[model samples]
Target: MSLPPKTALITVGATAPFPALISASLAPAFLSTLSSLGYTHLLIQHGLTPTNFGGTPSGQSLLSSLTNLSTTSPLKITAFDFTPNLSSEIATSDLIISHAGSGSILEALRHVKRLVVVPNEDLMDNHQKELAGELEAQGYLIEGRVDNLPEAIKKAERATFKHFPRSGSEVFGRIVEEELGFEAEG
Candidate 1:
């Protein structure tokens, strides 16, 4: 019997482009690591517009340069700017490597996918780092750095995650009822 193909999805969100995370994810070493771990496909959401930094290449251009460079590896690489159906993409993937945006993180977790979050350190105030760190500490996900993605990938492969409650959870409703001194119907 043959095992099913494993697919990993990487999303950089739609607002700010995270070129470093995109670059690191496509690095030869990282691709090799993913291939070794049985990830047969890699899908990247690289963001829509190029960043305004002088001389900094857009994620699409970076992807164009390296997309063909992995011919020796068995991983099939695909990339896009933005999509309205990202939730479906996340639902179909076996592993998710994401920028540390709350919306992206929550969406991945909502689908119960294995997640590795790489927070962009260049953002102002750097709250993404704090959020990723807290989630990692709580065992909900693995917090990864662009410089050490291969190590992070290995760790995430062996680590199990806690169940993230789905949206519209009863926990909040129960709290509200308690606060209002409402009695249970039973």
Candidate 2:
């Protein structure tokens, strides 16, 4: 019997476009890795930049070219620029690969999805790296680089993650209070 179809979602956020992450996620090696891991579909939120990457077409243009690209693996690929219903996509996905923006990270965590975070190294200040590193250190997600995504995918397949507390939950409140040294009043 065939295994049930599994979906992996990749989000690069809506403000700054991450061409490297998008390119890596769609690479033949990466798709093959996902296929071996039983993922049959790939959905990418490619963000809203029209810029090309080092003379190569990127952003919407790259996504348009995906149909002509050939891979040995039968991973179905699709992409969108932006959406208000990203939460629904996250809920349906068995795995998530995202740029290390805090909003994207938190959104995936809130859904308790298995996440692989790749911080865009080209961004100013490089804060995404710090956030991805901390989250990986905490066991909430796997931190991946553009060149090493295949390895990261292998790790994520066997990894178990810490449950992220829901917003406004008592656990979240307590953790915040403890961190801030605020005492609860009876």
Q: For each candidate, how many residue pairs have backbone atoms clashing (under 3 Å)?
A: 0, 0
Across 1-186, the per-residue lDDT of candidate 1 in tens digits comes to 966899999999999878788777767788889989989988888894353312223334554544455565688888788898999999999999999887888888889888999988989877778778877887878999998999999999999998887752464344335434578778
Output candidate 1 Cα RMSD: 6.2
lDDT of 1 at 150: 94
Q: What overall lDDT, based on C-alpha atoms, would model 2 receive against the true structure?
A: 0.80
Candidate 1 matches the true fold with a TM-score of: 0.82
Error of 1 at 4 (Å): 1.3
- TM per candidate: 0.82, 0.83
- Cα lDDT tens digits, model 2, 36-105, are 8889898988886443453223343573457655344488888788889998999999999999877788
Candidates in order have lDDT scores of: 0.80, 0.80
- The model with the greatest TM-score is 2
